[model samples]
Target: MSDILKFPKDFYFGSATSATQSEGTFEGDGKGQDIWGKWFELEPEKFYNEVGPYKTTTMYKHYKEDIQLLKQTGHNSFRTSISWARLFPEGHGEVNEKAVAYYRDYFETLRENDIEPFVNLFHFDMPAALQDIGGWENRKVVDYFKEYAKTCFELFGDVVKKWFTFNEPIVHVEMGYLHQYHYPMKVDAALAVKVGYHTALASAYAIKEFKKLKTGGKIGIVLNLSPAYPRSNNEADLKAAEIAEAFQNKSFLDPAIKGEFNPLLIELIKKHDLMPDYDEKDLDVIKENTVDFLGVNYYQPVRVKARDSVPNPDAPFLPTYYFDIYDMPGKKMNPYRGWEIYEKGIYDIALNIKNDYGNIEWMITENGMGVQDEDRFKKDGMIEDDYRIDFYKGHLKWLHKGIQEGSNCVGYQVWTPIDCWSWLNAYKNRYGLIELDLETQERTIKKSGYWFKDLHDNNGFEL
Candidate 1:
């Protein structure tokens, strides 16, 4: 084996997955149907080959076995989300006993194996009941979310010390309300703003409640921050990049970390007459409460430029209304995934947090590569996913650089531990250290998994 790359002794190294993505028992354990479950039943064709959320990595049954794989891969920690519907089937009123039992056992199992469990409260699995009730668009959903979050802390707090209120909150708003990728899909900027606001409010409320309970834990909101890049240094391109950054990254980053919404974002919303309905007290709640930590999901940087023509009909829409995505030429790219390969974006984010945002303790929560079905490369029960290994090496190098440069980063968790469902992409984009065999419930560790094990054993990798 090559000289292993290891992280600091205090730096956490693990993998992550959302409940809806990996746990296949979507309809089991009294789990009410989520939007994804309903979406598959309604129009399965929209998904890649009609594969639904239920046909996933089946982690519910295999978490015990999977924990062994994680240990073998040198994972001292692992991150996963609890299904909201699993915890509270109707999204607000009732807590499912079976889910509570399953999760209690799940955390226990992880701890038993000496794997620190980092649990997230929400991960894009909206209960269908809530969607019918206007989802995040309705302000009442905010209270329901706070209740759910409090319930989770009380239920699982004993075992879980690190809690994330939401994973990629902006992505949920952009996809569910601004874009038509997720279920309950609507293309309404006004609704999107309302949803994003409530998400922040809910996060704040969760933090407030967690503090009251005195869980001796940290609370945070996860954001998929892609440092926006201008197509050219020209004024228009540079301005477009700034706008894109404000719309995507700053929208949540400012609110959750700084406890205030972005002024430019607010003005843009007002300019478009796209302000959300909000009560006065909500702002006070957010201002008083902020996350204990942040989960930074840096997959790729965004390339943007000003739009040539305002999008159709002179009406407001998502960020696409003001800016357009422009692929930068002569930039290195990741072959496995079509996303731009800009490892420096990680350093920039870390520096942004350190210098601008007070450098609250953070982590590289979700960074990994997604390759097309990786099963064909299996050799003697293992996958030779060297590309995935290289992806880890490239990103980890930047992560180490950030840590050395006073970024206050604490941990690194890849996007997933096993192949899991990826929103509309479903199983199309495979990102996992362990290869999951869908047909037979078999799992084989990829080469990256071995590399991670050695890295963990050595406490840092040497290039």
Candidate 2:
């Protein structure tokens, strides 16, 4: 490797994890049940190997040691969400003092170790009490979310200067409402639209609260942006890709950054009679309370082509009605995870933000490869994850190119620092710089972790 690639002096190097995925004290220490816990209880077999959300890496019990591990891995910044149910057990009404103290200490500890905490308000772990009353589908839930966001800011804003309203809010809409991969599984397109609309509105309300508080900190949202690629330049293919882009990327991207929904998406929703019930005043709130920055959690690109057959009118309306997934020949893929590995997608996303979204300040909040049965590659008690290191280098090279071209991108954070429980998938796949032993809760830095430290210390790596 040659020392040719370099990042900006202030570019951050860190990792991200969510509370439900890391913290194991579910329903413990006065914590209430989240959707994940509730879903697991309702259907244990839905999760891989019946590994429910009960016992994760146990960050709640071992955060101090984890912070030391974060330092050893050379993290200057870290992102994690405060569990809403943990903070407010019933979603609203009363505060859980223990959860409050836990988060305060966690943020303070990270700050004391010189790691800037990038805290997010929600990460798909909605309080079951809120979900019991219709979750994001009901407008009332939006107000409850705003209250939760405000509470988080007031409690931990001092130590955590960077705040995010939500992490991949679309995932809840697409996975839970449309695809039935998550809790409250339903396949109603209209309900998906309503849930999505309310989620964006909730984010705006949180931003409104943040601005009102005058916290002197930047507030943003984390979006998992997958650039859409047309299979061909034909009019049909182009149109399909355009619709895919609107639904997959611009739905949340436009609302969070530009403070408006994409017109193409609006037109499509109206055509399908899926317009969400919304108050005009809510639109004004969204228009005014745009994000200060963006956190992009990019992992793959969506390749699209025109649908080969006419849609069945009798079937429930869905975004897939507009296009079909294009499996491009010879495309590189992650053998372990079955997702396409397109490094240039990062460059495409950066340039898209630069040219279209006003070049807003942003960072790669989550990008990492998840491999199955990682222990097979272990050698000398340490997992030699060279593939992960190369994966980072591949994506970073493109990110560097984008930044050099005036993309205004600031940092790159891996999906996680230590292997944690993934929702539904559980620990079937591991994506982390550190190898975690679930039985012993032992944290061991992998080969990629050492490589990341050098990259972080040097602010970049050789090409």
Reference-based lDDT, each prediction: 0.86, 0.93
Per-prediction TM-score to the true structure, in the order listed: 0.96, 0.99
The clash count for each model shown is: 8, 0
Q: Could you give candidate 2's per-residue lDDT for residues 323-441 as a string of tens digits?
A: 99999999999987899999999999999999999999999999999999998889999999899999999999999999999999988999899999999899989999998899888
Off by over 4 Å in 2: 26-28
Instruction: List candidate 1 segments past 4 Å from native.
Output: 1-6, 26-28, 310-313
Candidate 1 TM-score versus the reference: 0.96
Model 1 C-alpha lDDT per residue in residues 108-208, reported as the tens digit of each score: 99999988888998999989899888888888898899999889989989999989999998877888787788878788878888888889999999999
lDDT of 1 at 379: 84
Model 1 is weakest, by summed lDDT over 10 consecutive residues, at: 1-10
Query: Residue 306: error of model 1 in Å?
Result: 2.7
Compute the lDDT of residue 291 as modeled in candidate 2. Answer: 99
